[model samples]
Target: MLEIQFFQKIEFLQHRLVAVKKSVMVKTRKVFKNLSCLTVISYKFKGENIMKRCAIVTADLQNAAANKHAARIKAVEAFLPEHTEFLNKMRAKGIPVVHLQQIYDPNDPRKYKHTDYDKKFIEGSHEAAILDEVCQESDIIVQKHRDSGFYDNNLHDVLQAMNVEVVILTGMQSQICVQTTAADATFRGYEVLVPSDGVSATKPEDTERALDWMQKYVGTVKTQKEIYDDVLAGELIGGKHT
Candidate 1:
């Protein structure tokens, strides 16, 4: 009887040990499952949120023919065809194209009150329209009344939604609209790339000054061909801006 009782106690302890081992294994599996889920979430948050790395922002390239800034318009027009080809290549690579249109209200207090210059840019005026040579119906258009494209406009939101980490800024009036836009873009945390030949000013000195300022404090200044080649070779998209 004593031997049987001792054997029975040993059997009970063995059964308890097996049950405890099973319980530990279950808890371990649960912990590992939770860890696996967290790993997936981490990857998605870092990798999938930013779908695109670059966008082309053309600011205030409105009706060139009616524009009074003859010298600036002439400079921009010279490179329009080449710029359009660069845009085409960027578009083919699935980069977003954004055009900024400057529209002024005749009665708005912020408009230029001294000259009739603002009159041509009034809403629905021919001079306020974006150029057809560079803009397509499918492209995104952001209208603003100020020199800065981001001033009280949805441009930032649009770029955020597109996950654009870098902006290829191009347009008219290098020292005014383009410069302001580039500054704003830098403030908003987007890497800006201004093509030297893609933007213009009424005078060559003004253009040089704006480019130098932007390069020193705001963003990089490269030629249209250099930027186009990088875009085509996928170098810009891969976080290689130099």
Candidate 2:
């Protein structure tokens, strides 16, 4: 009778140990599965909410022709007051704003004999200097030699350092400088925003074509008022515009 009782006790002990082991295994597997699911969710959220930097590019607003041309200059002038207001608001909000100015160097090695028209517009020429009235001391200025602001310029570096994700373009000669810059920005994977009223070209048709192309291929096109409203409403991130 004593031997039978001991054997029975051993069996009961063995069964309880086996049951505990199974429970532990099941709990471990469940925990590992939950961890894997959480990792995937975290990765998806990070990918979707990636932050981007913002900047404004102002092209050559120098010569009288750019400021006085009936269609080009007049259009820009009409929107100047509101544009300035929006820029000021952006500045107050701590958004990065960059102004691109074209500088012509007569002795530049890159200057080609075939481009006489370009040669004549030397650095000190009326066409090269940024318009005095429109440019402000607070604005950050970058100089470029060619139609594209990115060509042999510090634009890329500046934007990179600032972590710029989007560029707001405004300037003269929409068909040339503005278009080239917008295309380059898109190629670099930066969002581009062009305010139709903030830019001008030598001709209405040319400006229209450039704007249309940018809107279709490069980035979004919005009016000055829309931008201003966004800023005022605090829709933009970073900081509020002053």
Choose the strongest candidate by lDDT. Answer: 1
lDDT of 1 by residue, 1-242 (tens): 00000001112354432111111112343553434221111111222233327888998878833257676566766777888887777776666789888886556685445356766777676787888788877688888878899998899988887777788898777899889999899888887899998887667788898898777556779998887776676656622223
lDDT of each: 0.70, 0.65
TM-score of each: 0.71, 0.66
Model 1 C-alpha lDDT versus the unseen true structure: 0.70
Model 1 residue 81 CA deviation (Å) reads 2.3
Task: Encode model 2's per-residue lDDT on 93-144: one tens digit a residue.
Answer: 7776777877656667773633655554465677766666656676677888
The residue ranges of model 2 lying beyond 4 angstroms of the native Cα positions read 1-52, 64-76, 107-121, 124-127, 233-235, 238-242
